[model samples]
Target: NRADGFASDSVTVLDPAAGTLTFLSEAAKLAVEEFVSRYGEGGKENFIKEHILKNFYAFELMMAPYTVGHLKMSFLLEELGYRLQDDDRFKLYLTNTLEMEELAQTELPGMASLSEESHLAGKVKKEQPVLVILGNPPYSGVSANRGKWIDDLLKKGYTRSDGYKDDGYYQIDRKPLGERNPKWLQDDYVKFVRFAQWKIDQAGEGVLGFITNHGYLDNPTFRGMRQSLLNSFNEIYILDLHGNSLKKEKCPDGSKDENVFDIQQGVAIALFIKKKGEKKDCKVYHSEIWGLREEKKYDWLLKNDIKTTDWRKLSPKSEFYLLVHRDESFLRSYEKYLKITEAFPLNSVGIVTSRDSFVIDSDKEALKRRIRMFRDEKMPDELVKQTFNLKDKSNWKLKVVREKVRKDEHWEDSITKILYRPFDIQWVFYHDNLIERPRKEVMRHMMEENLGLVSVRQVAEGIFNHAFVTDNIIESRVTLSNKGIAFLFPLYLYSDTDKKETGNPNKKRSLGSTMMLFEPKAEYTIKKPNLSPQLVERLTCQYKKTPSPEEIFYYIYAVLYSNIYRTKYAEFLKIDFPKIPFTKDYKLFSKVAEYGKRLVDLHLLKSVELDSPVAKFQGDGDERVEKLRYDGGEKCVYVNRSRYFEGITKEVWEYQIGGYQVCSKWLKDRKGRRLFLDDIKHYCKIVTSLQKTMEIQKVIDNIYPEAEKETIEFENK
Candidate 1:
């Protein structure tokens, strides 16, 4: 009843209502009962005369809810033997709390009629800052039609004329400082949190309580929001509900996979309070609850143990302060010793095609079929008959992309093409030169779609696959976060920016989870480094006097892939780039790098190299292994780990039906069947690679060591 220390003296209880009075009624009922319990209702007989008229208040944007809430509050008072009259100073009114203008109508998204509202039917002017500010806020992401009042609070500290500003308002986590300007703060719930703080800030002392998207607790993007909370509130309480399917983040406890809310994302209850004249550093308490339903969590909150700790123990000034930890000493050691930004100074989010169906695909043949379908239904010859040319390469984006075919000329001129994905109905672009194969063979075997996208292809054992192809390639991969391609892909690639000539690579891209290597910079629409030769050599070169790029790359890579790094830094791996730990000892670092090189060689070893030791091994699969793939013909690789080629972990076949999970597209027929020669080869590579990677952790442990995690072993009493 007294959450945030509500008392008889707290004459104002306000909810910037989301069209509900249910909470207000509960609060009133609690306030009346508590008053009776504590003071035995010394003189007051009616609840409204004693409590409701002066203390209860709410503001809503919609008229329907406002009216219903007003009536509900009146009836609730009546039920308690106190009837609310017309002049009883009914505090519930139609208003947009975010945009608390002098007027309430003509504001609120699509609620133009709520303009005629003031303090309790213009009864009480709330000049004093409220003692308690509380409610659940909407968690929708920022939109084109989002509230301007909220947007200003997100982009800047103050909204319109409400000039409450905090120094921590604009903080974005950085690699080279401001490298990652995260927009996740634009989420709706963040704005509400800020708004609550603003209300408290204006009052100079008050409590702000909210049940919200738990991302604010640990998402690196919301660090600024957390910072504001620290600056404003001296005492904070965080109750985490760990079930986020949007992130597919499971509860730390063994609860059901589903979250408390209907939505897929996780939720949390946070209470922030700062009393008048309190300016000392904030003290924070953290706890967690988990279950399939909201009621299960509620039951635990009231009846069970609350595992909590001092917030300072999490190291608030650290890069990811929201992580739960007993101590951050080892992490501090890694921070002082190693840094990833020294090598890779830039990164970016992968391309977002707004239209996925026409642009993205697992099967290139299927993509071509889409093109053919469009051609048959809507092609006009006049639009295709005209030959087009442009002087500026920039203008080429507006025209079309052409797939490289055997002949330069087109038999497709009459095939009706206003716009198609750079290919004729019958033609297929060979990702590699087609001098070796039939057009039909290229179409059937080589996976190529949309002119430059090549999904897969297999060839001779001696020949390199995908090592030499060029032409504005975009290896759109998000496997890093999913745990699949994260370890397998190179932190830096030794790509031939210029074909047929190879040495130290002139170009490189860091492909990994949580890292945004240089963003789309050039005409190719791919992220590139500042084009500094030193950066390229550092990540791509295999040999140098000392601290070679290959050595640093592998050293960092090996450290990143280890379970030590994963377990110790689990919180950071979410929504953040790697903050790599580096070493000054060339001898120790080089040895680790050597191991990294072996893994790299194994990972990049083309499936075409059939007889090579790396490509000849085989393994087995069973019911536990739900998905596996291997090319039935010549020299193809097998993936026994993930249901999808891009995903990291293995799971049941049912995982694919989820919108973004594409495991269903992998070769499912071979899942539980006998392992192929190619399949075993990849598994062997993973096992061998992991064995080598573990060495780096040991090497690092020898120097800037990790704290031995306490283990609990149960014995029979």
Candidate 2:
């Protein structure tokens, strides 16, 4: 039998002070005994050294970061009849691969005189032709690989030889990707892939393989990178292992699917092959494996190879050369509709308060107190930070805030009402200097009475049903379950003015103004309909009647909430902002618009229908949510040991907005806080709103088919 080499006990023997040397000695003895028994005692060492140590190239090309790893690797090699010696080749390198550099000067001119790290760097970079590079690079969205060499290489791949440094221009197809924030492309895994690709390209003909985060397979931001890969390689193979926990992915058979690695991000095995001589057009092949972790890793992957595995040939197109399979027919049909941004023509991302704890509060008084303390010149910056529990971040720092606070004149006036979450109103200090990203240009409309549609450009979780109405300033994460920012598309655009006007508070400033002035004498901020005039004219011509902007907004809301629309074009919605399909039939448009208006009223908690809620708060207790759980049989949700909310059905209890389960998330946020009478009533109203939303969605779905049958198509400008 082969010696075990104490492999099973390696973890226990890792501690150097815990007799690790003794364990290694025992393991070595076992290997020697096994070798002596296999051969003769006298010549066993010579035979093992000559045949195994010298011949096994793997033993002469090993690298380990730490002493324990080096010891374990050496122990394993010794068990296989190889032993380390003074004259042996430099294999065990104790160096950071990302930080490795060639030696400036050596004792002698040869590599032998240099350190192991320097020698390995020289060998990999110049001496050896790396035909194959394969490894699982770490996945970090906020990559720490800021080294000059790697960053320069990454920039080189994305840029042309002409040295063009335009804002959005990339080298892939010599066109701009038009991404606002493509920071995800700078992930560590992506950087490593770029590094490996650079190394392989330098060799002329080589293969690069990596099992990394699968986001690049279909993410729109990675389009440039995908095209770059196609331009470099002759053949590319992608084996998508679908197990993204954040998306809650399941096997096709309705069974639980798990990731091979203990990670939330889905992973894919990508192999890029570049052959010698004239390069041909890159051939892309894709496959997906989804099942139990063990079944996928052991049964499927172990049994499959490049030639054995079945792969579907793909012709990656321009704009986005996505590696995953897509329904081309659906994409073509879906592209006919008008995008939300194109319809509204004006939108901005919601406010991003980096110091949410310091700047925002559930209680108005608490926010006022913080602002007062912040404005006080007596209090130290560090003391204020500690009192508010504020940490210094890249965007917001105490010293910078202090400097801005000194010059501020209207600190008290900055406190404003904001929609922190769905149906969750909170107070925030909305000053440009106080808040990290106040988004003043868009928020000014909300500062007064206004309505805005909240949505996300991309949906990474649950569904693309994130559309909501907000009459107040919203947080960046108002619609998103993840770290993504939500955009606010207001119905009316407001412009700043220095012109002061004296008029009655109830009277409107102008004929076009949608809102009346709250104060008797104030600066008149001009407001106009944010709708596109050309699109409105097209809609008016199609219906033979001019539609009001409010009618258009409601019509859009209804279409976005339609179950059929969301399901039919679900794939398209995941990548970009939603598109609204205009119906030629005026009756269908009117009906959907009415339903949408009701939904908006209900969401804003202004509808009289919310007075009589279906769900009721029952039981007598502190009303503090301890461990929220649902009793499916009883149709009740337990907030604490004794208190519970009755009449909440399974569907209502599990209804998701954006990616959050509304009923559960509301309770979860107030886990330790006691629910007041108003809070209890508000929860009931939220439940009713969701229940009505579902009912309205079903109606929209029924009417959506009729609308789609005779739709008005817009020409792309």
Candidate 3:
């Protein structure tokens, strides 16, 4: 599958302008075509002996592909009129490349005898495998076994022994691992990379090139790997081909985008070269190929010397997009603000009920999660029949959950429950979990206005509409839905989980959103600390001389809801939690806090009441919908929809929030997995319309001006 340099330009009578197409895969064709077009010279026979057969190599795990690979090379040779020798010494091997080397070196647990060729492949390490290691590795699931050698790789944690020596010019952020270390170093592609790096290290001077997942280039999780490459490789090139659903990025030029392969995630081509010498003062050359047709992408790769371009000449060390942040206030806030972890270190996603049918049903007389289900809130008969084997289908087995004592257990009533769902850039809280039907009048009002939560109806195209289609796809996947019938998973947190769940407190308190900060109590301890507890404290106290969490959250909220933050920090927010910006001025803090509180209220539906004219409900039984109307029904929240749609009052579903399946923000995340309707409880969305959000942003901007562009600009030098 990692075949390279096989592009065919054979022409025919049909479609004369573009020429005829070859049946060969791009990689196979590129391998042959690139050689003929760029480097083929002199007699073909001698070249085959010295270069093609000797230097060219292919490693495959399966015999089928291995045979196909051999045939491909042979076919290409024959096309050049070179007859194949009987026992051609093609480097292709029918063995699993992942473990062959290690298995050959030393016996690991479950170690088995190896064939002569496998042993030889393993022995190549001592002989120096190659000066240039290149291939496309598998990118499916992670390795099930993290054998001893792999564990060592994870713990080794730095540049290879033969690295190009660190010069600090091409470095990435590094801190001692206590916690928060990237856990994905074991991913298949990363391991292949690790293997490639090892080969180069053994050779002392070599090139490691491959087309693989582009995530390692910028994802915070792969920082150490990046740093290792920076320290070890003298020269590097990264050509990011943005197509993965995880990125949710469009073609930069507005062209239709699809993954470069059958896979849903984006891919990149990286070439790392190191010569045995002193460290060179160079950054990795990085370029991007976005939204091009499949043929054009392959053509570009074939035509370009990926290593010779200016990559990081633009934004070498900045976060994705190479944009720098120079806001003094932001810098100050980051420097001084206390992190949220200091206060409420405890945090977790809302509760996940693994078996909903067995733990819940609709009858108020029936117990679900130790509480009786409100009679009107009964699950559909079809849903119950599909999932549970109940006595008359009225009973559920909840004792295992309700009776089991766990660390964060809470009393039924006191438990903090929220329909916590991410809506695009915001975490939309749509309902409270009380397991009871709302008052009829209130339900009617909300349903009519499309503002209040209704009985869960997960059937798509019923209430919420599709958020957005990936490329041209419009189908929905059902297996991953929450209730096996509906798609939603309410956030569950116990009252006892009160001590943690912290935020970063900053001095720029003039802006605010869902963020808030409080001081670390003497009794507070770190929960799920990504950084060491010691570093957490140091980082939490870095900026302010005498740090205080005073009104920190409000300022964060203000910034979060600000147009500037959303528009600028859009990329950062997708992969990581909000790192709020704070300010020291109390006046600015309070003003921003006010806006945050208003947003909080607006989302909580505090402005409207049960009897308010805007509150309304509709339908009966399954087809029911709820709403909250304003501006004479011109604005509303369709509390129950596959996702919000459009119209002044139409609420469109946004798949980008929470990276959830309902949002479809990252299709590559759980590729081929189903999305439970129960997990998508907040199909609910709110908006008077698109312009209203913008106008609201304007109000915020007027209250406190955003940092001007001049304030953040920096010269390339």
Runs off by more than 4 Å, candidate 3:
1-47, 78-88, 100-114, 157-174, 177-183, 292-315, 318-345, 349-351, 356-386, 389-416, 420-550, 607-697, 706-717
Most TM-score-accurate candidate:
2
What is the TM-score of candidate 3?
0.61
TM-score of each: 0.65, 0.80, 0.61
Per-residue lDDT of 1-717 in model 3, one digit per residue for the tens? 112222222210010001011222233334445556665644545555445555454556654565676677677767755667876655555455456344344333543334655765555534534665666666644665366664455555435455433322122443342223244566777877776776666566667767787766655455556666665677777777767764455775656666677776778887787777656743556677766556666666677774454465422442222211222334333323333233223322222333333333322223334332222135544444444543331233333222232221232322221232322221111112322221222211111111111111121111122111010000012112221121211111112232234321111112131222323333322111112233224424543342233233334445556766555544443333344444434445567767654544443434232112221233223322333222325333333333222233322223122224332332223233332342222222233222233455567777645432212111110
Of candidates 3 and 2, the better by lDDT: 2
Q: What's the distance in Å from true for residue 345, model 1?
A: 1.8
lDDT of 1 by residue, 1-717 (tens): 344223365546766644668767777787777666666765345545746677766767676887788788778877766776655745777655655345544545643343445433333223545666677777776533257766666555642113434544465342221423355666667766776677677777777777888877765556666776776777888777767775555445544656767886688888887777767888777766666665676566667543433233334765545634434555544454323333443222222233334433434566456444333424443342232221224423212333232133432221111111111012222222211221221121112111111111111111111111112222223221322111111133222232224231212222341122442222322222322344434323323343434455666555554455655654444344444554434555566566555544433332222233322333443323453453434333344552222212332222221122232333342355544445444444433332332444466455432222221111110
Q: Whole-model Cα lDDT per candidate?
A: 0.46, 0.72, 0.41
Q: Which digits, one per residue and each the tens of the lDDT, describe model 2 over residues 454-521?
A: 99887775567788999888999888645367899988766654123522211223434444332212
Residue runs of model 2 more than 4 Å from their true location after superposition: 1-129, 156-173, 278-280, 377-383, 393-395, 399-403, 498-525, 532-534, 714-717
Report the lDDT of model 2 for residue 176: 60
RMSD (Cα, Å) of model 3? 12.9
- Give the clashing residue pairs of candidate 2, or none: none
Who wins the lDDT comparison?
Answer: 2
Model 3, global lDDT: 0.41
